[model samples]
Target: MAKSTLTPELAARFASIALGHVRREYPNKPDHTLAGPQDAQTPSQLHPVFYGSYDWHSCVHSYWMLARLLRLFPDLPVAADIRALFDEQFVAEKIAVECAYLAAPTARGFKRPYGWGWLLKLAEELALHDDRRWSERLRPLAEIFAQRFRDFLPLATYPVRVGTHFNTAFGLRMAMDYAVVTDDRDLAALLGETGRRWYGADADCPAWGEPSGDDFQSSALIEAECMRRLLPAEEFLPWFDRFLPRIAQREPATLFRPATVTDRSDGKIAHLDGLNLSRAWCWRSIASALPECDARRAIAEETADRHLAAGMPRIAGDYMGEHWLASFAVLALEA
Candidate 1:
C-alpha cells in the first residue's frame, strides 16, 4: 500500500470537525469542564467525564487538544478558554503538587494515579505559553514533583509500572521548560536528572510486553514521545522501532473491550470495556511518528478513520476516543 496523502480540503475538514466537536461538546460554563448532554445515560456519553470527574488528566488532555487546534487554526474561539482552564483548574489548584502521591484521592475516592504524565505534559505546554502567572503557578508543582519522585515510582498498578515513564518524562519536560522559562540552571538540572532516570532505569522493564490494544499503545506512545523529546536519539530510538510493528498491527475491536472485570467465575468481558481509550490513542500516536511510509500511513489513516466513524465520542481523557480524534487530526493535518 502506498502512503495516503492528505489534501488541504481533507485537513480542513478534519480540523473543522475537531474544532466543532470541541466547541459543541465542551460545556459553556467558566468552570472549564465538559459535561455529558442531558440525554447522556452511560459514562461514555459524558463529554469529558467519561473517565470520571474532571481532574488533571482530563484537563490536560483537553489542553493538548486545544493546543493542537490552536496550532492548526489560530482563530478558533476556544483557545483562550483552554488556556484559562490550564491556569485555573490545573495550575491554580496545584494538582501536580497536592496530588503528587500515586495513591491520591480522586473526586470519586482513593484511586491510583495512572495519568500523571499527562498533567506534567500540560505544565510543559503552559510553560511554553510564557505567561508570568503560569510560571509562578508551575514552579511550586515542579518542586513538589521533584521531591516526591521516589514516592510515585514503586506503586503497583497495571499501567503505573510502564506508565510512570510518561509521568516522569513530563516532570522532566516541565522541569526543563521551567528552567528555560526562569533561567534557573539548578531547576533545569534537577528536572533533567528526573527525566533521565524516568526514561533510564526507572521505567525499563525486563519484558517489553505487547500492549493489549490501540488504547494501551496510545498511552504508551504518549510516554514514549515524551521520552524521545527528553532523551538522546540513540537511547530511545530502539524502543520506538521495537513497538512500531505491533502498533501497526492493532485491530479496532481491541478497543471496545470492557474496562474492568467483575468476576473470575464468569469468563466474560465487563461493561467497563468501552472506557479504555488510552491504548488506542497511544497506537495512533505511534503511527503518526512514522516516516510516512506506505504501510504505516495506511494503518494510521484507516485505523483513525475507522475508529472515529465507529461511534467513538470525542470526550476528554477518554483516551480511546480522544486519541482516535487526536491521532487522525495530527496525521491528516501533517500529511
Candidate 2:
C-alpha cells in the first residue's frame, strides 16, 4: 500500500506547528538591507504585518499554510486562532505600514521576487475561501507586489535557476496562483510570456548538480513545476520528456535522492530539509502532469514519497528548521 499523505490529522499538526512561530517575534532574523544608520528598526517595527517566523518570507508563507489548512479542514482546532491573527494584522493600517516600507528609497528591491512571491501566495490562499473579505483587505498589498512582478519580470533577462530563495521558477509558480483566482489577465499574460522566455526551451536537464548546502528548493524540480503551469497539457508532456529524459533510467541520480542536513542548529544549512519537501511537492506535480502510461509518472511519484519521507521526520527538531519547515511540508503534502 502507498504511504498516506495529506491526512486531516497531519494537516492539523502542521497547522499547529506553523501557528506557534507565525507570531513569535523573538530571536528574529530580519532580511533588512539597510541603506544607512537611519534605516535601523526592529523586525516587528519595520514589517508590522510580517515580522515573525524567523524571516519575512517565512512569516508570509506560514500565513499561507494556515489559510490553506483552514480552507481544506475548517474544523481544525486552530481555526479561530488563524482567523484572529488575520483580523489583528491583515488590516488597512498595518498593510499601509508594509507598503510604506516598500516605498522607501532603501527598500527599492526589499524582498524582491521571493518575499514578494510569497506575499502574493498568501493573498491567493485567502482568495480561495467563500469569504472575499480577506481577499479584499489584502488586495492593496497584493496589487503592490503584482505591479512589482509586472515591472520586474520584463527586465530579468535570465532565470535564477538555483535551489535557494532567489529561484525564479518558484516565485513565478506562486505568482501564477494569485493570477488565476484574481482573474488578472494582465498578470497571467505576463507570466506566460516570461515563463516561456526563461524556461520554454529547457531540454535534457543535467540534474546532477543539486542541493547546495543552503538550498531549500530543487532548481530542476521547481523549473519543472513552472513549465507545467505555463504550458498546455499536450505541450508540457513533450517538454517534460526532453527535460528529464532519463527518469526511466534515473540518470540524474541526484534528483531521486534527498539531501542530508548536517546541522539543523545552523539556520542556512538547515534549508536542506526544505529542499526535500520542495522536491516532493514538485515531484508530485510532475507526476500529476504526466500521462498515466508514462514511466516517468511512477518514477515521479516514488521519488516524491522518498523525499517526503526524508524531510517530514525533521520538521520540528530545532528552531532553525522548525521556523519554516511546516510551510514546505504543507506545500508537499497538499501537492
Candidate 3:
C-alpha cells in the first residue's frame, strides 16, 4: 500500500473526531489525587479547559491537532467550528483554574512530564496563529509547565527509558518544540544539555524491550527522534549511525515491524496501535534528518509506511483508542 499522507479531507476527518470529544467529558479516566474529603472534584471541575477526550493529556493534544489542522487547512469546512471551540475554552479565567489546580500540593505530579509536554505543544501551535488570542491566554499555564521542566531536569539524575508517559525522552521531545518556537534560549539550552546527559553515549541500541505489552511508544525510536530534534544534523547524524548502526539492514527487526493490536476495545492492548503510529512518526522524522540519498533513509521510510498502514485504519474503531489515537495518527501522517 502507498504511504498515507495528511490531506485536506483527512484533516477534516481528524478535526471532526477531536471536535466530537474535546468536550465529551464522559467515560473519563482521571489521574486525580484527592487530598481530602473536599477534594473529590469532577474532571471538568478540576480542569475546565482540558476535561475531555478521556484524560487531561489527550484533551491537550487533541486541541493541538485541531489548532494545527486549522492552520494547515484554514479553509477546511470545520474551521469555523474549530475557531468556536477555541473561543469557548481558551479563556483566561478557565486557564487560571487549571493553574490553581497545579499549584495544589496534592497535584505536584499530576500528569507530570507527559501532560506537561502536550500542554506546551498546544501552546506552541496556538502561538503560530498571530491573529488569534488563544496563545496569549494559555501562556500562563504553559509557563508553569515550562518551569516544571526547568525545575525537574536538574534533579533528574537518570532518565526514564520506558515506552510510556513517564519516558523522559518523549517529554523533552515534545517540550523542545515549544522552546525553540518561542526562542526560549534558557529552556532550549537546558533541554539540549539534559538530552545529551541522558542519551549522549548510547550506541548500538539492542531494542530488546520494544512493544512491551502496554507500550504506546517505541522507547528506542523516540529517544533517537528526541536527539534528532535537539542536535544539529552534523552532530545528530553521527550519533544516529552509532545508535542504530544496523538500520540499513533493519537488524533490530522489531523496530521495523508494526505491532499487533489484538483487541481495540481493551485500552491497554489498544496502546499497541498507538505504538505503531508513534513508531511511524519516529521513523519518518528520523529518515528526514538523514541524507536524502542514504540507503537508510529509504529503509526507514519504507518501514514507516508499513507501520502507518497497520495503525491508521484502527484509529476510530473503539472509544478505547478513539479519544487519543487520532493525535498519533496525525503525527504519523504529517511526519
Please tell me which predicted candidate would have the highest TM-score against the true structure.
3
lDDT of 2 by residue, 182-298 (tens): 899899899989988998888999976786879989899999999898788988888888888898998688989989888889988898989999999999988989889988789
lDDT accuracy of residue 108 in candidate 2: 71
Which order, best to worst by lDDT?
3, 2, 1
Ranking by TM-score: 3, 2, 1
Question: Which candidate do you rate higher for lDDT, 1 or 3?
Answer: 3
Candidate 2 ranges with C-alpha deviation above 4 Å: none
Looking at model 3, residue 242 earns an lDDT score of: 95
Better of 1 and 2 by lDDT: 2
lDDT of 3 by residue, 1-335 (tens): 57789999999999999999999999899998888988898999999999999988999999999999999999999999999999999999999999999998888888878999999999999999966599999999999999999999999999999999999899999999999999999999999999999999999999999879999999999999999999999999999999999998897999998998888899999999999999999999999999888999989999999999988898896999999999999999988
Using TM-score as the yardstick, the better of models 1 and 3 is: 3
- Residue 29 lDDT (model 2): 78
TM-score of each: 0.47, 0.97, 0.99
lDDT (Cα) of model 3: 0.93
What lDDT does candidate 3 reach at residue 109?
82
Top lDDT model: 3
